[model samples]
Target: MAYNAGMTEIQPSRQVDLAIIGGGAAGVLTAINALRAAAPGQRIALFEPASAVAQGIAYATPWPEHLLNVPAGKMSGFPEQPGDFLDHLLARREAPEATLAEQYVPRLDYADYLQQRLAEAAAASAGTLQVVHDAVVSLQPQSGGHRFQQAEGANWQATQVVLACGNSMRPLPLPAGNALPPGKVVDAWDYDGVRMLAGDQDLAIIGTGLSMADCVVSLLAAGHRGRIHVLSRHALLPLPHAHGGTADFDPQPLLQLPLRARMRQLREHVRIAQAQGLPWQAVMDRIRPLGQALWRSLEEADQRRFLRHVVRYWDVHRHRIAESVHDQLMAVERSGQLQRHRARLDAVLVQDANLQVHGRGTPPFNVGALINATGVETRALGLRNPLLQQLLAEGHARPGPHGLGLDADPDSGQLHDAHGAPQPGLWLVGSLRIGTLWESLAIPELRVQAQQAARAAIA
Candidate 1:
């Protein structure tokens, strides 16, 4: 609970087994896993910039309305505790009839759950975890390990560093032509930005992706109904969830098959499931265990092909919106109160109070007030985080293929260097290693990675 103020320099410990740079979900899981894997008395540290450790973009829900996409049964922080979230909800009297199938809850509660977990780990740690709440600006490889240079300007040394810096947003290209004096274009993650809106405000949302959908919901929840328009290159919406069903996951035969053949077989199995009435999410869940194998099986060219042709579609289908939230969206769509357009934004200009944004698609666009909700900006690495840019410049870590994310080995999240060798002690977690493992953004997949990455960190 004690986080450093802004930043302060502290003497590096002479010896420590693990040092994680990110304190988001992945970092939290990594800490627990390290506690699980490391010998007692082996030192561990997690660096986080937020006021508290483990507060990532997703759980930093400012408004009470923001909720988790996954149901309680599936939302548990620990994979082994499949009903952990449900139990928590039940104990708190927040459980609905369909705890696993339909219950949706605020994200702050999960944040609190993580905080409690951290507290438990801290108490049991016996000085095992040395969590520092400071922004890590850069990393430099030292003898057998690395040195972390703080963003607020400090230093620490550790044998290992996990880059769980989650959710690096893509920056919007500066609008050409007249520019808004200020406060016209907003990012979807702008939790505090809601205060800037007034009743009866006309809002133009750029990129109708998941974040855009969430933003629209927030706007509607705020009673803003002047005329909301969504502009994007594609009007494609997220694929709906098919609820849940009991499905047996047997991975033995998959483990026996050759990589490519295994991927082909699993793809066919998923297709058959969808044909038989199993929802896409259910099929994906069944496929979770094989995700890593399937990713590694694909040749580099095939991986690129999937990214170009299928990544977005896969993401929308995989990370579903809750039924309640989706129904709310349907209401907006049916009433014509919300408009979805497929087109390229030509330009945006701000002249005093009036913000003008142009577009090119069926009907030309000129909407007022725009918000960028393009979800994860896989390509905008440098613009996404100052920490990443500085690290890339200092040669601590190199960018992955096509700037997908930090490069790493299949099992270990150890980021690679300029010559494509894994940096000695640096590791990444969750979606940050997406470039290495394509089908990663989910908790089940991430939980496994957290354990493996921690074990690999001992290297």
Candidate 2:
């Protein structure tokens, strides 16, 4: 449980076969897979400052109400072992009644499954796998390998390094030149702080995404009776999963078309499916497998166009909410306790000890608190992570396309330098591959990326 602060300053330096820079699901899976594929005595080092591995921000929540967007059946940590997650849940007897394959379980349960898998992998690997509870601040290339410097003054050299650093928080989108009052704006993740607010205090949330949904859920669960104002450019909410199982559809035709044409085709297919008594979720589920290929086929202009015009709509459909959670949100909206506004935030000023929020095409409003649920920080070079900043400053890594993530070889997950040359022994997994693989965030895609990166790193 020792983090960067309490770690003994041994300045531990060792040469290992592989070094993974994160302990989230991606890093944990990569370590497990790499260790299984490595030579008998090969060593692996995993650096994570968190209290436990595999419980990244997404799964670290303790709330039972926060459920996984995807079903239990599709959340396996291993690409080859599709039933691993369900098996783990069954073995632990967690939620035996709702253990059906299509159930969207709590994210906390998923975190337990991941931790259990990581422990099992480590135990099976004997003494080859080592967990280092510290954050890596910089990665420097050396002869035949890379040297990593930890935040706690420890350094190590590895033949290969995997950057599984997941998404960072986006910068708060507050209006400029405004002297905000204390305790007015808070991060969506600060659940405790948010819970301390008065029940009848008016609140304004900055985004209309999953995080925003979670905030609303938390407030409602805490019996908050205040009016919750959700503001965004489009005010689009996530769609819910279908009641029954998902049906299959072919995405090959859509993949062959241009971005706009593909979108039109998808809309037509959804319309056809709805007319035939099938849910639109079924159609989107069919395209999940072809997401990466379809994204790669788009021209840069088309990609930008997709981001500008299609991202919000696509996100609402692609990343859905659990049926129960969706129902709760709907109930709140129906009760008039929740209000949605489609206006761009212009400024936030403090007036009479309350936050006065101004949005384009809308009248100014006052709120007791503001919450930022703007989602992940997509711009790579602007991230607050010291390691990434150091890598970019030292010319070891470059920003990915459209400022999505770090630049890496799409096929191999190998990190690239500022000169656009692929660096040996450096890899990226998970959301860091957002630019290369558009569908890299979720477990289904990340498991494949972890397997691919592990194979290349250990080869």
Q: What TM-score do all the candidates reach, one by one?
A: 0.86, 0.94
TM-score of 1: 0.86
Best by lDDT: 2
List, residue by residue over 134-253, the lDDT tens digit for candidate 1: 777777788877777777777777887777877767766545454554567778888667435635766777777778777877887788767778877767776556565634556557
Supply candidate 1's per-residue lDDT for 87: 69
Model 1 residue 176 CA deviation (Å) reads: 6.3
Candidate 1 weakest lDDT stretch, 10 residues: 1-10
Best by TM-score: 2
Please list the Cα RMSD from the true structure of every candidate, rounded to 1 decimal place.
Answer: 3.9, 2.7
